[model samples]
Target: MNIAIISPGPFSVPPVNGSSVEHDIDEVTKMIDPEHQVTIYTRKCATYPKSSVEENREFIRYAYKGPTPYLQKIIKHIRKHKPDVILVENRPTYVLALKRHFPKIPVFVNMHSHVYGSTAMISKAKMKKVVRLASGFITNSEFLRRHFMRTNHIPGHKIHAVHLGVDVSPYQEAKLHSSIKKLRKQIGLKEDHRILFYAGRLMRGKGVHVLLKAFRHVSEKDPLARLVIVGGTGYGSNRLNPYVKELKRLSEPLGNKVKFVNFVPSVKMPLYYQLGDIVATPSVWKEAFCRVNLEAMASGKPVISTPRGGIKEVVTHQGSGFIIPPKEWSKELPIIWELLWSAPHIRTEMGKQALMRAKQFSWYATAQGYLKVFENAVAKREAGKQPLQKTG
Candidate 1:
């Protein structure tokens, strides 16, 4: 089977660290069944050739001015070497355009977030039409599967929710004493300090402000506790946005106890995950999934996250980590902090369990899920063609 994966235009493949969509694209393609030839289309990155086959996967990068130009760049490439199946990541409208151009091929749209399919971004009628044209709608979590079905009115069979995977080996590897110590020294972490890490976009939805508020209380009680906030407003964005100002204000009393690290790419995330003795996502959004929980688990750290969206799927309350109810995070954090600090052995045991759980969610499993979606979608679409076409 020949497969073509089209990443959104904003980022390049092999991920520049800021784009989780690109990172998923890069990881999935690497673990794809080698018998099938894989081609990836992404926006241009200066470091890589426009067209190059590295490790058996072909990457085609085009200079992108905007989404329209970038889609055209992909169209020109597809006209020449059309694949058996095409996977569109992030943009729902891309599926519509691809279906219009290549009526026979199976085009699957994989949604990383709820932002695209929501009526806020596109009209409900247009979203339904996009769903009608595409072979399958894939989401990063089952929660999102129900979302599109309700919002876009897509049939249950046409949508699949495949959980994203993490390359745990990097996080696992970074646990070596010297490597972790060097990272700690660089961050100015004290030997006795217990780090509380928060990584993700520094915005309202990610609960950055909520994290600061919770940490201010955590710091006042436990002098050894340190809060490390990772990520900028967006990928590579360093400007202090308004929410960041609010977060700074919240952290004022804690002062040096709170550390806001700038945005680091996906490559450095492994070590950063290790920076936390215990990680806290503390998200308030009903996001499709939080890769932070997965990465933190992979690094053998317990996470304190809300039971929102797919986070409930990855985090087990008092098993691998704690999944606090959204309404209870404020009341619960102080209690959970006391428990973890008093019984440090639970942290070690939970870390072991977290790593074991993290091992189950591998990039190889992610690829297999996509491959299964490809096979089933192709078979279903082909079966629906010709005599069954009009009804479909």
Candidate 2:
């Protein structure tokens, strides 16, 4: 089968660090059956050229001079390729356009988060229309699937929950001691220090401030504990962003115990995970799914995250790690951190369980799940069944 995947205009396929949605698209496309042809339509960034073919898949990029013109380029390519199915990611407006222009073609809309959130690039009304028009909907987690169904008034059957995948090999517990020692020495971390790792955007809603507050309490209890923040404002920015400045100000009294490493490349992320004794994601807002948590778990480290969105689905409380409720992070996080800090044996056992759980979610399995959804949508379209419409 021939497939065409449409990505958001801001990033390219196989993103460097962030861009989870783009990363998922790239992984699914690459890992899918080689017999099936896949082409990804994304913006032409400095790293990716206009057209490149590799790993039995193709990437076609467009320069975003303007929305209308760029979309026109996309439509032209879609017409030329004439794919069997179309997969659109996170761009509801473009989904609407694709469905309108190619009414007979099956277009699957992949929702990475709530359509009404601040990160949504399209309007609610347009998103509703896209939901009604698209052949099917795909979400990264059951939490998002339920949220979309409730908010958009769409039926549960029309949406599928396919968890995102991670490459767990790099994160495996091999050369653990050597990697830890090397990273600790390079980063000027002491051997006795307990590192709390947080890797992602330094945004307020991500609950970096909450992590700081919790870390302060933990530091007071365990003088050897340290917080290492690894990220920038967002994708592509490696400097001290406004949020980083705020975090730095919040950690002022804590001194060098709170270390900030700006924007590590995705390839080098496993090293940071190896350096961490525990991974903490104290996001106040709902995370559709966090890849950081999975990466940390795959590295044989227990994660301490909030029970927000689909996070609970990933981090099993008292098993892989503790899921502290967002409201009680100030009191609960430090307690959990202290417990895990005191008992290295418990951490080791949980880390093993975390690695085992991480194995269940692989890019290969994720691609196969997506393939099943795509095939079903295409079959429905061929049988003259209109896309599921939103019911009143």
Candidate 3:
């Protein structure tokens, strides 16, 4: 089978500094069976060349920066070597275009956010056209799958929920004493400091503000606790925006109790994960799926997140981590932080369980799930059967 993947057109593959969706594309391609010739498409970046291959996969990057040119590049390539099935990441409109260009080919549009499924980004009439044309819809989590169905009036059978994965080996490597010591010295942290980590877009919707608000009480209660917030407003974004500026102002009273690490390359994230004694992902809005949970869990650190979207599905509350409701973070955050901070043994045991849980969600598993979907969609199309009819 020849599998062709289209990136959202902004991020480069190998996920040098892109979103988790790109990272998913990279890892899933690497783990996909060697028998299939996987072809990846993404916008070109200085960090990566025009074309490259890793194992059984091949990358054909476009120098064009935006969506239209990116689609043209993909169309040109597909005309040359058409795929068995087409998978477009995080772009619902691309589904309509691909289906229009090659009506016979099966195209699956992946949904990574509520914004994409809702009428906010795409009109209802256009979404109906997408539903009528698309072979299938893929979501990062079952919660997202269900939410999309409700919002878009999509039938359950037309969509599949394939959870994102974490490559645990890299995070496990960060646990080495030498690596830990090196990172500790680099970050100017003492051995006794209880590092609390938060990574994702530094926006209000991501709940960074909520984390900062809760951390004020946490900092006053625990002197040894240090909060380290990671990421910028967007991918490779450096300049602090208003939200980040507010975060800075909020942290002023806490002084050095809080540290903000602006967006670093996706590859170097594990080192920051290693520095955390505990991880916080308190998303105020519905998160389709947050890969940071898996990354933190793989780092052998217990996660502290809210029960928003697919988060509760990923984190085993009190066993692997704590999933307090967003409403209760004000009271629960400090207590949970105190509990984990007071007992190293509790942290160790939960961390072990967390690592065990993380192992189940490997890239290999994610690849297998996607491969099955692609094969089925392709097989169904090849049989000369009509595409799935629009369901509401």
The global Cα lDDT (0 to 1) of model 1 is 0.86
TM-scores of the candidates are 0.95, 0.93, 0.94
Candidate with top TM-score is: 1
For model 3 the local lDDT of residue 135 reads 86
RMSD, each candidate, Å?
A: 2.9, 4.2, 3.9
Instruction: Give lDDT tens digits, candidate 1, residues 278-312.
Output: 99987888978899899999999998998888888
Which regions in candidate 1 have their CA more than 4 angstroms from the true location? Answer: 177-179, 381-392
- lDDT by residue (tens digit), candidate 2, 305-332: 9989999889999999888877788798
Taking all chains together, the TM-score of candidate 3 against the true structure is 0.94
Predictions ranked by lDDT, top down? 1, 3, 2
Better of 2 and 3 by TM-score: 3
lDDT tens string, model 3, 121-183? 789999999988888889989999999788788899999999888888988887764677877
Reference-based lDDT, residue 52, model 1: 89
Q: Point to the candidate with the largest lDDT.
A: 1
Runs in model 3 lying further than 4 Å from the true structure? 177-179, 385-392
Lowest summed lDDT across 10 adjacent residues in model 1 is found at 383-392
